[model samples]
Target: MIFLIYGTDKDKSHEFLERLMARFLKGKNFFSLHRLDEESFSESVFNGLLKTDSLFLNKNLVVAKRLFQNFAAADYILSNLEILGSSGNVFVFWEEKIKDDFLKKIKKYAEVKKFDSAARPDFKKKKEDEELFKVADLVALRKKQEAWFLYQRIIMKGGPCEEVFWKILWQMKVLGLIKRGGGRKLHPFVLAKAKRAAGLFQEKELDGFLGELVQIYHDYRNGTADLAVGLERFILRV
Candidate 1:
């Protein structure tokens, strides 16, 4: 069986993958396992590996990290997925991010699992925290309309405006650190999400957003601007 493991939680996704491989190899008499990363992988290499006969091994496992990010590799794998299955190799595709349409298509042939960053235990403890992440993620993904809608919902639920504001700021800070070549101390999951989201805005844009947010907070405190309206406008402008 092929396993397509992806999403924001890189550490857990890799842990799960290792556990799966261990489970598969536990009682095996002979097993063949291979690993490849994006830089070391290509359609030709994968095809040759698939077609090669493993006479001594009863099971085969090929772990590829971010292989689908390459168009040729993705196309080859999608087209020949059934062939891979028939060849008796358990292929694992691990990625931090992937195209939504490709993920949907792979579900038919692969056991797909997504480990969302917001679904962690800490965020699960408070419903509002989960909602806050939704807003933060939407903004990071540049889904401004959805971010504004979720922000409004959080406000209606009496969630602290400052809490949401700080979370967004924190998310931006993480992204800024990534863009500026820092954040080595962050959790693997947080680092991965920040790297993925950093593409949405340039360093100058992030700095501008933070400055605007500071002014908005000042205006709110002085009673010159409605916090909710100011925040909503900020989300749209991002």
Candidate 2:
């Protein structure tokens, strides 16, 4: 059998792959596993295994992650979908994203599962959180008036200053990550935006802003700075 587990919710898709493996291995006397990732996957390895049966095991479980990113590997796999689906071995494939045209062809022979980022539990932001996110985004774009206006609107609506502070902190951290993190953990769109914002400021300038925000947080803790007001001032300066 062939299984395709993929989408922007990579973490969830990977978890699904793990669960399938676990269920397949449980109560089994003998089993074989072959795992492929972007860095190490080869068409030769896949072809060799595809043509053979497990020596002592009932079946071979092949797990491939982001293998389709390699055009050659993807082409080979796509070309052989028929036999791969009918083989005694099991193949579980994972990808961050895939094209619909190719997916339709795979569906004929594989069990397809998708995990959309919007459907992910962790990606479900509250309405307030979206407002805060917009505020943070405006800050990234260096639009003082828009950022300040939204910040005030949030406050008027009973949104907490602490939430504002934390969101800005997180955005700043994302900017920093763009500078040095490569940030594979972040969603691609978020990373791309941060990267676009990175060129707007010098590294030293970003570092200074982080230093100042931390000091503001400390001052808030010490009752010397009102967080809401301080963030407003900070917004103007950044």
Best by TM-score: 2
Q: In candidate 1, what residue range of length 10 has the lowest lDDT sum? A: 116-125
The residue ranges of model 2 lying beyond 4 angstroms of the native Cα positions read 54-58, 119-238
Clash count, one per candidate: 0, 0
lDDT of 2 by residue, 68-184 (tens): 888888888899999999898888888878888889999999999998755435453477689898999999889889999999998886565777888998988888878875677
Off by over 4 Å in 1: 53-58, 119-238
Give the lDDT of residue 58 in candidate 2. 63
Task: Report how far residue 222 has shifted in candidate 2, in Å.
Answer: 45
TM value for model 1: 0.48
lDDT of each: 0.79, 0.82
TM-scores across all candidates? 0.48, 0.51
